[model samples]
Target chain A: MRIGCGAGFSADRLDPAVDLARDGALDALVFECVGERTLAFGHRDRRADPQAGYNTLLQTRLRAVWPLTAASGCRIVTNMGAANPMAAGRAAIAVARECGLRGQSVAVVLGDDVTSLIDADTPLPLSGCNVGDVGRDMIGANAYIGADAILPALETDAGLVIGGRLADPSMFLALLRHRFGWDAADWPLLGAGTLTGHLMECGAQITGGYFADPGHKDVPDLAFVGYPIAEVRADGTVTITKLPQAGGMVTTATVKEQLLYEVHDPARYLTPDVSADFSGVQLTDHGGDRVGLRGASGTTRPETLKVTVAFDGGLLAEAEVSYAGRGAADRARLAAEIASTRLQRVHGVTEDLRTDLIGVRSLHAHADHGLPVAETDVRLRVAGRFESRERAEAVLWEVESLLCSGPAGGGGFRGRITPSIVTHDAFLPRGDVPTRIEVLTA
Target chain B: MSQTQTLPLRAIAHARAGDKGNTSNISLWVNDPAHFAAVREQVTADAVKRHFGAQVQGTVTRHEVPHLHGLNFVLTAALDGGVNGSLNLDGHGKSWSFILLDMQVKVETGTL
Candidate 1:
């Protein structure tokens, strides 16, 4: 049984695999919803645009593909609802139960809220060593729940499931592997599938974007991006590939680049299961467009769990303006100073008015950061708290007006700093606890 | 004459085979000189010459570091650029995997 998982996002862009590969051959699919703009990455001083978080473009596209998936007969799951997975699940279950899928179970995995589970006196996980204390103020702590937890839901024969962040990719993987009864110790095979899941989890990693050959000349009309495909075997070996006729090159090099993409430790590539030593991975070109991946041995699984949460961090503000034309660099530097001084004089305080000549390193570093501001994007993001939401909402209105008043006409307002509770937390489920798995269908 | 190394399917599928030029890096143990001779004979220089093709410069040289308890070889460059090599990833070429396989040839314990 082929299992797959990927993050939720706008479908029209690149990374067509999750949307494209909804056929019957795929046993199950899990879509993870994370709010992001077109080019989500390191703090962009100027983001082109950002869509509303609650409004569901990611889900709309995800749901749009459902008819195709149902036609092909693939079970699905997701956490695209953000703060509303329960509501989203209810809506989806309504859709599933519509056509004789009532008993067709779809688990709604919650329990991400663990803010009060531990205690104020309880040691946080990342604290001092000698105390043996994990004392952490998890103002925001969600369950670092793993797919093993979702097995019960899938076992219930649920056709649809919704959940919070469970390491995202493992959503599709756990359900499919468990459905197929794939062995956990089957490291090589499991690793192959897991690797494929990892590549597809982010949608565009395996596509021509991150993994494309740098020196290769002719590209397969990148205007049309193709999604990746994994030929997962019963034995656990999965050969990842794209459409046979896709435009991008799916060589070992592209795969290698993706494998190396943002990995912290090559040897200790941690996950829910055992830790696989990525340092020892090998890629072979076994003819055709296929690149065979082999030998991904891992160590014992971890004792604790990891999680992500958001909470109220109060108000944070930022502002920047490009210093373009001649002496643009000096002009930007002066503008930032002026803005800082103006704010300080007005409110008896200086908000963080960061200035940049784009491509330049950073102001903290004395040297010319990187870009030589013939024209640079100047951005400022400031956050703060409000006695009331109305007061907080007023800041954006003020900044938009400041766009015209700032010394640099280029200085403009961008995105909103919505009042959000920045949550943060992680858990360490004891290894000995049989990791209870119960599947019930109604 | 390319030597054929009996490896678990994954070794090749993932391109884990060490590629020092053209010679392959392998994970095997030899308790005696005869075994080395056997390995040397079985995985001959001619094999290296045959696999990489003519673009490479010369005979492959084997390097066995006692520290590693493994064997690594460097072969000539065969398919240098164009269709394959040019793709740059993070400013590095995805052209080859010579060093990658060199590291995977781990001689497990209990085997002399």
Candidate 2:
């Protein structure tokens, strides 16, 4: 069976998956969207509009990939559901109908929401603070579930599976398990399957999306980069490659880079399905864009399910002004110090206030190969977080004041203040977060 | 006759960096299998820590994937409180691998 990745994230390019569906001969196309913070933002959007919680690009992605998938019989699985899978399922049907695919079966995987399961006063594992502390300030609580939550949907002949906070790998793994009838208890096979999913979860990352480095690791024609396809067998071996006419190159280096992406422990990479072990994993070049994966092992699944609690972290505001010509570095630094001092004294905002000269030193806080004696241009930026938008705006206000009150020849000023989502990650026992799946046809 | 040359880690290896919370993991892979030994030896956790200097506050743990010819360095407290909490524009520290790959290393001159 073959599975192809469409969009790695909600904001990823939508055109590549269309190419995958058109030329790659895929049995399924999985789009893994919805990051932890993204769900929080989705929750906030849902509160304002009843039908507005799904990924912003859901319609565009569905329109672009669904018609092709519908024609070719390639099933769709995605976590674009964000805070509301049911609504997203409806949205998927709407997109299908709009795209002239009227008979698409969309499934909504349920039971990931566990807000009611947790006591309001229960302290989150990461923050050690109760949800009640945030009260209405809390945006959303989503439990990270795995493939089992998605399996029933795939089994129901649903052409599309929409999930909220489903573990990214689970979407692809469910397709493999459902197709091959791989028993959930088969730990090694599950591990290999999960490894395959991990390698492809980031879409083109494994296929040279993020691997290109000029002369060091050159990827050809990245503008039209090809999405990855994994050919899987019943016993759990996978040959990962892309379309023959695609742009990117698949090599051992690309596979190795992606294998360790976001991985904390190689021996104990935990997902809801299995504890995937990549320590002993092997990658061999099969030549011609095919890389074979083996040696990945798995133990039992984790006892608990991880949950990310996103709360209103108030607002973060940033303001910047640039300076150039001759004494630019010194002017920018002076402007930053003065702006920060004035903001603290006048606006009484100091704790979270941070000032940095962009061209002089911002990325590396420690690595100052000694301050530039004479920079042609520099941007001085001041940012701060506050409990209220008014207070946050005060920092920006003070920085803007520097336009007239301080600095020499500083121009190109910009300021922004926006609501911030602070995430607190926690885990609950599996028994408490029982997952259920349901199918909806368009 | 073979000789040694000091060059950036990128000369012999390439790396990719990923972050979780405040910890950053950088996987460095050698261009050739023969140089895996040199990467395993010279690219010590201490050396990585020093290379990053004060950027990495917590400890560095190295994992060796010999079959794949790769070295994974887990750097703690490196992301400045990470995505949700960092003030840096690159809160995810996605490009940190390039910095690590730029670390100077002494390798056999003929390896390149």
Candidate 3:
């Protein structure tokens, strides 16, 4: 069986997916689009507008690839449904109709949303507090559903299968399981399939998109890096490669980097389908942008499903001003001090405010180990989180005031305010969240 | 003893960092197998914890993949509240891999 990755994340490039559908001759194209925060925002979108919870790019992506996949008989499996699979299903059908594609069906996998099941008393493991203790407005919760939830959808043999919070790798694993007729209890085979899924789920990551570093680890034609494709046998051994005409190389380095991407433990990588073990996985370089992998095994699936509970985290306000020419570092530092003092002393706001010198030290400054070097250019950024919009606006006002009131030669002031969402992990008994599948024809 | 020189880990390895909630995991792969032993010996959990300093709030655990000449460091409470809550622009800590790679290690002469 052959499979290709259409998307790695919710905001992935569309042209690459279109290229895969046109030339890949793939049996299935998996688009793993949902992330923890995207799902939370999806919930927020749904609350505001019922039809807006799905991927904002769902229609555009479908319009681009659905016709090509329909012509080639390559099925699509995706979590583009985000927080609302039913709405996403209808949207897909609409795209199919617009494309003049007939006899195409879409299967919607449901039951990942468990917002109604949770309450104020529900315990959150990561925050170490009850839901009520979060002291914020609750958005919603979604369990990370796996292959079992998606398997039935695949059984319908629909051209497209849509779901919400479907585990990233499960979309690929479900297609492989359906094609190979692999048993759910078969740990080793499931592990091998899961390994294949994990490798391909990130799309271009395994194909050298994120692996490029100039003068060190160089990737060819990185500007047009292609998504990944996998060829699997019944025994679960697989070779990962990309389209020949496309850019990016498939080597052991790229594969190894992706093998442990976001994976905490190689001995026991947990998923709802199985506890996959990538510890003993081996890679074989097949030359010409092809790498082979084998020996991934698993034990059992987790007893409980992991759910991401999202909350309205109020507003994040940010403001920045630039300082250049000689003594820029010192000027930026003084500006940061002024902004900090004014926000705290004058404004009487008491939220944790962060001051960053963009050019001199920002990301690593929190460690407090690096010394500031003399630089001609520096940008001072003041940021803070506030429960009220009025207080959040103070952060921007104080930083903007630095132009004339605090620092000399400061210019290029920019400010922004955005709604923020906080997510926490909670587990629910697998039995409580049963899945249902519905198929709609286009 | 054979001649050796201290060099940055980036000279011999490449790394990528990922995050889960408050935890951050960085996978470091040595470019040459000959330098894996030296990297494994020097890049211990405690060494990593000290290297990161206040950036990491919780314990650091390193998982070794000897067959692949790789080490996975899982740092807990490292993101300062992760993506949604953190004020840092790079809240995902995507650049943390370079921070790990910046650590210096002693390597055998002419191993590059």
| DockQ metric for all predictions | 0.02, 0.64, 0.73
Least accurate 10 contiguous residues by lDDT in model 1 chain A: A37-46
Fnat values, candidates in order: 0.00, 0.60, 0.65
Kindly list the per-residue Cα lDDT of model 2 for residues A320-344, writing each as its tens digit: 9999898898888898888777777
- Candidate 2 residues lying further than 4 Å off, grouped into runs, are A120-123, A126-136, A368-374, B1-3
Q: What is the lDDT of residue A361 in candidate 3?
A: 85
The i-RMS of every model, in angstroms, reads 17.5, 1.6, 1.3
Score every model by TM-score.
Answer: 0.63, 0.95, 0.98
- lDDT for model 3 comes to 0.91
Reference-based lDDT, residue A44, model 3: 89
User: lDDT scores for all predictions?
Assistant: 0.45, 0.85, 0.91
Q: Pick the candidate with the highest DockQ.
A: 3
True-structure RMSD, every candidate? 14.0, 2.1, 1.2
Candidate 3, residues A1-442, lDDT tens digits: the string is 9899999999999988999999998999999999988998999899899988999999999999988888888999999999988999999999988999877999999999999999999999778898999998889999999999999998886999999999998888888889889999998899999999999988899999888888879999998999998999999999999999899999999999899999998989998899999999999999999999999999988999999999999999999999999999899999989888877888888999998988878897655435456678899989999888988888888888888888789999999999999998899999999999999998
User: Residue B29: error of model 3 in Å?
Assistant: 0.5
Winner by TM-score: 3
